[model samples]
Target chain A: MTKSNEYTDSSRATVNRRSFLKGSGAVAAATALHSPAVEAEPQAAANVVSGATTITLNVNGGDHKVTVEPRTTLLEALRSQLELTGAKPVSSDGSSGASTVLVDGKPVMASTTLAMAVTGKNIETVESLGGEDTDAVPRAFVKHDAQQCGFCTPGFVVAVRALLNKNPDATESQIRQGLNGNICRCGTYNNIIKAALDVVKGGV
Target chain B: MKNFEYAAPCSENEVLQLLSDQSGQTELLAGGTDLVGLMKKMIVTPDRVVNIMEVPTLKNIEAVDGGGVAIGATVTLDEILAHPYLEDYPAITDAILGINSMQLQSQGTLGGEILQRPRCWFYRNGQELLDTGQISGGDNRFHAIFGNNGRSKFVQSSRIAPALCVLAAEARVIGPSDSDIQMIPLLDLFRTPRQEGQREHTLLPNQLVTHLVLPPVNGGLNATYEVRQGAGPEFPLASAAVSLELDNQQRVHQARVVLGQVAPTPWSSAAAADALMGQPLDAQAAETAGLAAVEEATPLSHNGYKVQLAQVAVKRAILRAAGLETGGL
Candidate 1:
């Protein structure tokens, strides 16, 4: 097992998963309020974040204790600190949703979200999907040949999964609106939409 | 983005204290959709970042008395779009939906939406402002036409502000000067930046938007229409939001018409409202109101097309609000 301090390419993913599970229970209450009963954020008046500090980000069902400055976006921490490079960084402005991830089961642009802001929140990335068995999202993408360059595929998959997870009966218009956040420069939108629709209709 | 000190204040009081201490040097991090991009472009490099995402008081969206909605400043655009009650205010919802993309809606907050920076290419490229301390006339195709009297011609980018203005909503603001929160009409919140160096909002750097208090719809017909360059997430070239309260005869009793992307702020047209008052809600009346709305529009060199687009948007919005089938104009 890699030590928590080191974030090398080989052992980055493993380190977070092992350490995260142990500490997740303690910080769960401080995270965002899940639906049906939305509540207030934890009131810790003394918790002033300044300078560089070690932040525990619960990502992909793993606890990633990474040291970062306040300006480090969740996208930066995911790619550089945890070595989860599935989500692409196409635009600094987040006009392209290439760095999308699920925050509290909702699709959010990881590039625009500060890592420290989502310290205790549940963050699901492309890495968490299609674990041992290939999931339906990836299967449909492969079946439809939904990607040309594949730069935006991960974000699309993550976005589609989050959309279906929330609204399984999403119509074509809703699907289009939901996935509109992501952009594919190669113009694979038609195929990508087909892949999502197929998964929605249980075609794959 | 430059390295900055970060603070995720859990309470409103803590945030106020941080703002007091850091003042102009601190930038509040709500959704970070616009601020992060600005930072990456070096448009703004604050010394400290105060992350207000965890402040629960600033994230509430409760229905206010008299059938209005009191939206917490930190409420995300997605949350507002998903609310079932917002359906009554179609103009506001449609305008909010037309902004950016789904991912941006997910990350953008209600407070931040109204306070968006100018998206001019010259400004974004870090080109120096003109000697007059404003954006002098150049290639201003995407700039404002109505508010072009000033040197800065950058069109205001907030899609929500125009809708909110038509709805007659008010903004709840908390500042260091006031012991309690202050409520100002949403329209008064926006200001034309006189010089290039000036910020867009009337609020001070230490002031924070706490909530957006929407007035009761009161059985008004409301709608919004936008003319975008593409079907994708591109910003609108021209957009309009209108609310109409009709009498027993279906004649317009009251009207609030507001246009976007043609001015430095959401431009409200009293002339359009006056033209529609006591007039029969018909195509000709809507057309007249549209024309009246753009009478004051002074188009920049390359943006004469925007005036026509703005007219169409207003006309269509008024017709749609009245449940009239708009024949292609």
Candidate 2:
């Protein structure tokens, strides 16, 4: 969990395009491109970055450097690059909590979050929860049999842990509201809720 | 997704310059919840993705000159929900709670929520925005009933638009430079796309929504009531937001009622407001207002049920704002 300044990938991974115009927000002026094809008028803002670039991500209290494009999501970096595969990819819309990970203690859908956008964030995936003997969330899930297909178990466990970490005394209704982000396609919601409740009631 | 370049500008001028200087298309990324999904489906393929979450100016939530609050565009929904100054505005908070998912509330910004695109199945599946023929013939159980004027049948997809519109919120937009700023009503920002180049919003390709200003409620009480289908992070079936101020006799002196998921934009019903203007909020008055709200709704073949739902939402919103019993969940 100590901070590591090591570059996992030393080379500044080349991106497809290079940086463009940069300036101030309050006092500085900006120039507009003449074309209309790729223009975004809604809320045009970002550091001009194109092609692949090496960026460091701090996940599970450990910093891991990875090269990613603008399109490479946090979930992609966690699973594909860093091999932190606890977060699942159930639905692309990110409504499913299967890709849920806590960034700075907020439950966010990693699949929808671009890796470059969360470069300096504190990410905690399900793997961050210690071994089977140490984490009570997984224990509660096992005791309550909160899985059938088991595809959504890791996410549920992580999401439940996150909820409990924030609200240790979260009631059943609060648990339902808190964990609504994660869905069990196998219809294990009843058991999942029970597991969360067990953890809340100190039964786990 | 396209191999688009990404930019994370620090200042407003920098973002504006990138929006204009970049030859190809550039999309602003705030939460990336809705935009990423669209990009993955190839519904929108921008050449450059702009990350505006880190911009210092767009991150403020402070009290404005009026007793009202001015929230920066990048302020997250959960942050707004937690703000003490907004406690009286249940219309906005209730709508945010109705958003249902913590992930969305944690990541989605007020500007993103107000400016999000439609959830029309056809549109999401890659059909044109004005593809009225397919919308008319396809499965449109969740489509619009009031503002489907053959140009576009897709309903406005923002969950909190009705609430913000009823509050008469003003959006502050920044163009190419600081002098090129425009402050328009929040509702004025939306226009159903008529052409391929046009979008749901009226913003020029270079403009950015810097912040939003909500006028003080003074002695007004506001509430939002939504008729959701069921549990687990789904869009509302119908919704109504009411911002009302009553006279000494508990008679409605001012009323603003706006409906959502029933039209192309947040449909503010003057008739509904008029129905409540002189009367004390009661079951009969609420019923009358609700009926007036949906009287002009022209339901499509598959979705006549939404008219009744919209009516119920209006009735409940008024009753809730008056602190009266809604009588329905």
What ranges in model 1 sit over 4 Å off?
A: A1-46, B20-24, B128-137, B325-329
User: TM-score for all predictions?
Assistant: 0.89, 0.90
Model 2 over residues A168-197: C-alpha lDDT tens digits? 999999999987777887898999999899
Candidate DockQ values, in order, are: 0.23, 0.26
Candidate 1: lDDT of B143?
80
What i-RMS does every model get? 15.0, 13.5
Candidate 1, backbone clash total: 2
| Cα error, candidate 1, residue A56 (Å) | 0.6
lDDT of 1 by residue, B230-291 (tens): 66788899989999998999899999999988888888999999999999999999999999
TM-score of model number 1, chain B:
0.95
- Candidate 1 lDDT at B241 equals 91
Instruction: Give one digit per residue, the lDDT tens place, for model 2 in B116-212.
Output: 8899888888997775577777778998888887677789989888998899888877776544666789789887766665678878777888777
Superposition error at B135 for model 2 (Å): 0.7
